[model samples]
Target chain A: MFATLACVAAMYLTPLVWMISTSLKPEAQATDGSLRLLPVPASSVVERARANYYGEEAAGGAWKPGVWTDPSVDFPRFMRNTLVVCALSVTGMVISSAVVAYGFSRVRWRGRGLVFGVMLATMMIPFAVLMGPLYVIFGRLGLIGTLAPLWLPAWFGGAFNIFLLRQFYMQVPRELDEAARMDGCGHWGTFWRVIVPMSRPALAVVALYHFMFVWNDFLAPMVFLTHRDDFTLALGLQMYQSKAGNTPWNLLMAASTLVVAPVLLLFVLAQRQLVSGLSAGSVKE
Target chain B: MTREGRENLAGWVWVSPWVIGFGVFMLLPMAMSLYYSFTEYPMLEGPVWVGAENYARMLGDGTFWKTLWNTAWYGAVVIPLATALSLVIAGMLTSKVRAGGLFQAAVFIPTLVPLVASAMIWMWLFNGRHGLVNRALGLVGVDGPVWLERAGWAACALVIIALWGVGQQVMIYCAALREVPESLYEAADLDGMGPVRRFVSVTLPMISPVILFNVITLTIGTLQVFALPLALFQNSKGGPGQVGYFYTMYMFDKAFADGEMGYASALAWVQLVLVLGLTWLMFKVSGRVVHTRG
Candidate 1:
């Protein structure tokens, strides 16, 4: 059992390890078919890293003047665009979903159950069905070629996030709400002072999930954003891959590592929350 | 006004965002999509009504049929393999292994890599002459096929790529496995059931509902797989002989690249029906097999 598990682990880890290893080598070494995991002589690692990241210009090559003139991808700009989308979408999703969830779980009102049922049904409708008309809608609204199409819809509650938060909110003791009400608190005050404070873990889960979603999303950016300057990291990586005919495998791997690094770091830090969130989303009571 | 009326008003105010969002983003778009599916609406021009013309054209369109077959084939192969592989791995991890968390992390980490990045990594690994996969196979004195260059091999390459991200399903399976009661195992032991029999008779039934749930989610996900193959082939059209060209990719191309909005809307509707039908079929077939606890 131990040996089998070890083999499975090695199988899974090899691609990631190879991604990093290939990024450290020079172009020739990367495609040489040699099994060596590092650059030959290993002293040129820093030089190779600089060339791969900042382009040949960093290694005593001719400097280009304009952004379009430079052959190297503007990775930092793409990272900035991706971060902007993530920040806007994650914040909006968390706050809006929490507000909507409070209505579903905390308040007793007519037709609430029916409305919640409709929201759950909406989750089953795949995005493919919406992407067509959404393109036209965004074009008409002049949101194409801008980042608004990517993050604006998030201000409205996502069905899944709202459901997850509602599930969490339902577990909050009703007595706390009563206590707050006795102190002359309305629904807004109770939600702010009592529910939101207590449900931080669940809110964090929603925020993290949405952050990763926006970060990894490729198709939406591909369909909505037209300008190369507006591209997210995922879209930029694709553009980088296809732009060069004989793209240096080493540099490509380096770019891939940059795109994957932060998500891996986040995974290491929040594995528990992510794992529980995954189970919570699928495994029902 | 009565207190109930005031509470109702408050509820409407609180949930208004989602209500408005659903109306504009979902219901309105769906109605428009259905309307546009029946017309000849190019992006640059207004819709001209063409009753069922787009759907009829799909019947004779060779690429449409090819892409549909490719997508269905890919989903049929990927879904079961991913589910079973993850379930087995999850089973192994749950059986009191030391360093289980470490092993689980190794499995789960790949799912964190974005689709485009993973596609790039796999492209290098599956390169015909110099890739690590071919190099490893060469160690055993076997010649490796050019993965992304041929028809059958390209489809096989995509299947392999799909299997790499089974880590998420594995994590979910691990959680489900841990939830199975210990007393069932004891009962199986008392009945002198062997390990394999114990797993089949006891563990499988206990976690069958989770298996069903995972399969449904996997079906929905795998059917809409777009980014990985798009990034892998690096073309709006798919790889060699269009084997990697999928339903969503075709829809995307028709809508955006070709500006065949009406045709693409028709394709989208067909995909929606296929997904709904397959999901319903799974539920129907699994009605007897999936064990729900009382």
Candidate 2:
């Protein structure tokens, strides 16, 4: 049983290991078809790593490599663009979704049940159905080719986040809110003083999930952002791969590693919350 | 105002962002898309009404049918394989294994990789000449075909990539498995049932509802697969024989690349109907099989 489990784990992880291994090698070693997992001649490891990332010309003051040195496919710029979008969208999504969730969970009013039901149903409407008209709408608003199209809609509450937050808020005792009200707190005041402070972990889950979503999103950026300057990392990686004809495998892998490392780091840090949150959200509701 | 009226106003005020967002982003677009499907609109010009032409044209478009078939075939193969594989992995994790958390983390980490990065990683892994996959196969004296350059093999390569992301479902299954009653297992053991028989009778039925839920989600997800194939092929043109083309990719190409907004709107409507229909059908069919607790 131990041997079987080890093999299953290896089967799942080898591709990622190979990706990192490929990224560190020079172009010749990467495509040599040899079975070595490391760059040949360990003495040249640092030089090869420098060349793969910072470009050989910059690292050695010599001839240029291909796509890695191209200024337009700037990795740092793409990272900045992706970070900007993630920050704006994640903050907006968390705040708005929490407010909407508060209404659904804490406040009892006419038509609340029906409105909540409508919010849940909206989750089933696939993005494919929305991309067309959304593009036209953004075009008319003169927001196409800009980052506005990517982060603007997130200012509104999303269905899944609202549902998750609502589920969390429902567990907070109504007595707390009533006590705050007894102290002359309004609904807004009670929400901030009582509910928000208690739901930190759930809020973190929503923020992390939305952050990952914006980071990983490709189709929206691909459709809306026409200029290369506004491309997110996901789009920039594709642009690098396709635009760099006969792209060196090592540098491509390096770019991929750069794109994947942050998400992996985030996952490692919050593994418990992310795993539990994902399973709980799906299975319970 | 009455107390009830005051509560109602406050509730609406709190939820106004979503309410306005729902109308503008979802309802307005859906209504516009439905209207656009019946017209010939190419963004730069005003829409010209053309009754049923785009939908009628779709029936005769070979690429439309081809992509539809490709997407359907992908969903059919991927949904079942991913479901079973995840269930087996979840089963293994639940059986008192040492270092189980380490194993679970290893399985779950791949799903966190961005899709574009995942595509690049798989493209390198599936490379015909120097790919790790082919090197491993060569060790067994088996020759592997050029995956992305071939027709049938491209689809198989895609299925393999889809299987790699089944860890999310596995985690869900693990949670559901822990919720199963130990008394039922003891009862099965008292009846002299073996491990396999006990699992089939006890474990399977208890977790059937979660399975149904996961399968439906997978169906919706797999049928709309776009990024992996698009990145794998490195273009919307698709791989050899258009085998890598999918329904949404085609819709995207028509709308954005070819400027056929009306036709793409029609395709989008068809996709929405098909997804809704498949979801409804799954729920209807699984009514007897999914054992939900009261």
Candidate 3:
């Protein structure tokens, strides 16, 4: 049983470890020659690449034993773009979801169920179908080639987050609301003092989940942000992979490693909360 | 016209953003898209009422039918496998395993890898000559095909990437599994039933609603698939031989790339009807779904 568990752990973590290992190895060692667990001695790196790549050439005369040029890739810029996008989108999502959730959770009104149903139904609609229409709309608004399309939707109330928070808010006892109201606390005051303060687990889950989704979302940004300079980390990694003049695998790996670690760390930190939320607060119980 | 009315107005005020956005972004667009499906506009020019030519074109496009077949084939293969994988894994993690939380977390990690970065990772794994897959195959004394370069193998790669995101669904299953009643398990044990029989008699019936939910949702998701192929194919609109052109790709290319908005809108309406039909079928079949409220 222990061995099986160990295998499971290894299977899950191996790619990540491989990513980090490939990142640290000198460019020549990981990509060109026999991909090794340990980096080849730095001195033998160029020789190995030459013998492996050039010696296998159709004509030896046509081969050039290109010297190893450890390319310094622009990892920092890609990492920055990722951070900015996640920050903007996640912050927007948290605020928007919380406000919308408050309306659903605490406040009472007519047509509430109808409004909630619309949100739920939209959730069922696969986002892929909306892309072309959104593109045309954004283009007409002159919002093409910008980050606004990626994050602006969050400010209008994302259904997934609204549902998540609304579900969690229902779990909070109504007596708190009654108590706050008895103290002459208005709706805003009651929400700030009672509901928001108490729903930390749900809020944390919301923010973390939002961060993960937006941080890893490449397709939306890829479609919307067209400029080379505007690429986010997800798209930036691909750019590095296909860079002109002999793409550097090591540096691309390096950038990917840098980009993925923070999110991975965040996931590990919040795993319990996230998984608990999945079972407990997710799916609108 | 007292407390209820005041609270009602406040509630509307709070939710007005969502209501307005939903109307503009989803409801209005959906209705407009329905209208435009009958026109012959390409966004560059004003739409002219053409009634059903684009729909007829879609039927005859050859590519459209092929894409639908591919999307359906993919949906057919993935939904069952993914749903089953999630259920069995969730059962394992929840019932038999002690490291339930850790295992759950590990499994969900792949869903976090951005689609593009994961695509890069997969390309390396599937690299024609020196890929890790081919290298692994060499160790087993069997030669590997070029997974991405070949049309069939590219489809296989698409399926694998889609399956990798099954992590999220697994977590959802894990959530659902916790809600199952222990009394049923106790009843199974007391009846001297074996594990398999116990699962059939008890576990399967209990979680069937969640299973149905996952299937219906995932099928919808798989049918509308686009991003994976777009990432994998990169610059080539579809994939090798347009094999990666799921119906969504055809629609996207028609609207944006080919500047044929009216045609694409037609395709979208067709899809909307198809989806609604399928959803209705699922709902009709959902009578058998066992909802465990506990």
Candidate 4:
């Protein structure tokens, strides 16, 4: 059992480990005939630093080492672009989904159930169906080349996120809404004072998931953001691979590692919440 | 306003963003796409209605058939394999291992890596000459095929990549595995069932509904796969010999690259029907196997 578990772990972790290992290798060592996981030891400490850590131009201007100094891959700029998009989309998704879910869960009305049911059915409509029409719409609006189309739809509330939030909102006590209402609170007041305060965990779950989704989103960005300056990290990573081709394996891996690090960091920090949030949202619902 | 009137108005007010959004983004686009499907719209000019021509053209489009086959082959293989792998991993974790949490985390971390980034990593790993995968294979004395360059190996490569992201499915199974009643296992044991027998008779049935749910959802997801292949292939040209070319990739190429908006819209509708049909089929076929709680 232990051996089996170790093998599984090795399988899962190898690509990631190789990514980091390849990122540290010099260009020759990266694409060389050798298959060492680490850089060979240099004769001197300065040479080792130059070969493995610091960027250096080897003899005859053949190779440049290190990811950051490679200059072709702009990690920080893409990171900024990704962060901005994620911030807008995640905030919009949480607030809008929570509001929409409030309507579906907390409010009572004649058409509420019917509308919410239709909304749930919308979850089944794949994004593939939306791709062509949305492109046309965005093109018509002159937002095709901008990041607006990529993040703006998030403000409308997606069916899946709304469903997740509504399920959680339903579990909140009805007495809270009534008590807030009895205190001369209107629907907005009751929602802000009662529901929002009580649903922090659910809200966090929605926010985290949305954050990851927007951060990891490749297709929308691929379709909408045409210019290199506006490329999100995921898209930028692809652009890097294509522009560089198979030559710069080390830098390619480095770029991939940089793009993957934040999400991995978030997972490491909040694996429990992430796991429970996703499982509860899907399986329990 | 009357009490009911006030409640109804407030409800609409609260959901107005989604309602407005649903109309503009979902309903309007769907209508436009349906309209576009029957017409010729190339983005350079207005749509000209041609009435089923786009759909008919799809029949003879060889690339369309190839992409459909590729997508179906991917779904057929990846869905079941991923499901079983997730379930087995979940089973292993639940079997009282030390540091099970760490092991689970190790497995789950890859799922968090964006599909685009995973493609990059795997592209490097699947490299013919210097990739770690081939290196590892060499250590085991088995020669690794040039994965991305060959049609058969490319499909296998994508499946392997897809399997890596089964962490989400694994978590769902783990949660479901925990919900399986211990008494069922005890009863099976009392009836002379060993570990294998107990797992087969008790655990599998108990978790069957979750399995069904995961399978359906996975089916929906895998059928629409795009980003990974988009990242993996050179020039985003789909995999070697178009073996990794999926349905969405084709739709994307038609709409954006080929500028055949009408045909692309028609393809989108076909994909929608196919996905809905397959999901429905799963519900029907798996109905007999899925055990619901009383």
* TM-score of chain B alone in model 4: 0.96
Relative to the unseen true structure, what is the C-alpha lDDT of residue B190 in candidate 3, on a scale of 0 to 100? 96
lDDT per residue as tens, model 3, B6-69: 9899999888778777776677667667667788877777778988888888867887788888
DockQ winner between candidates 2 and 3: 2
**Model 3, runs deviating above 4 Å:** A1-5, A31-35, A42-75, A243-248, A281-284, B96-98, B292-294
Model 1 C-alpha lDDT per residue in residues B93-156, reported as the tens digit of each score: 9989989999999999999899999999999999998799999999999999999899898889
TM-score of each: 0.97, 0.97, 0.89, 0.95
| Residue A117 local lDDT, model 1 | 95
Pairs in clash, predicted candidate 4: none
Pairs of residues at least 3 apart in sequence or in different chains that clash in candidate 1: none
Q: Judged by lDDT relative to the true structure, which candidate is superior, 1 or 3?
A: 1
- Candidate 4 per-residue lDDT, tens place, A1-285, comes to 877987898889988988877876767888775767677763343554455434677789877655545557666677888898888888899999999999998789889878988997887788878878898898889998888897899999988889988888888899988899889998889889988999898888888898998888887887788888888888777877777555577767777878888888888887778887877776674
Alpha-carbon lDDT of model 2 = 0.89
lDDT of 4 by residue, B1-294 (tens): 999999899899999999999999999999999999999998798999999999999899999999899888999999889988998999998888988888898899898889888988998889899887888799889999999999889988999999998888888888888888788778887899988888888988888888888888888887789898988886546767888888998998899898989999999999989888988898898888888887
Cα-based lDDT at residue B153, candidate 3: 90
Better of 1 and 3 by DockQ: 1
CA RMSD of each candidate after superposition: 2.0, 1.5, 5.0, 2.4
| Least accurate 10 contiguous residues by lDDT in model 4 chain B | B231-240
Local accuracy of candidate 3 as per-residue lDDT tens digits, A1-285: 545655665666556666666655655566663657656676664544344222223365654221122223345555677678788878887877888899998998998998888788777665555666777777778988877788877777789789888988898999999999999999888889998999888888888888888887766776688776667777776666656534555545556665677788887687777777666644445
lDDT of 2 by residue, A99-139 (tens): 99998988889999999998987877878898989988998
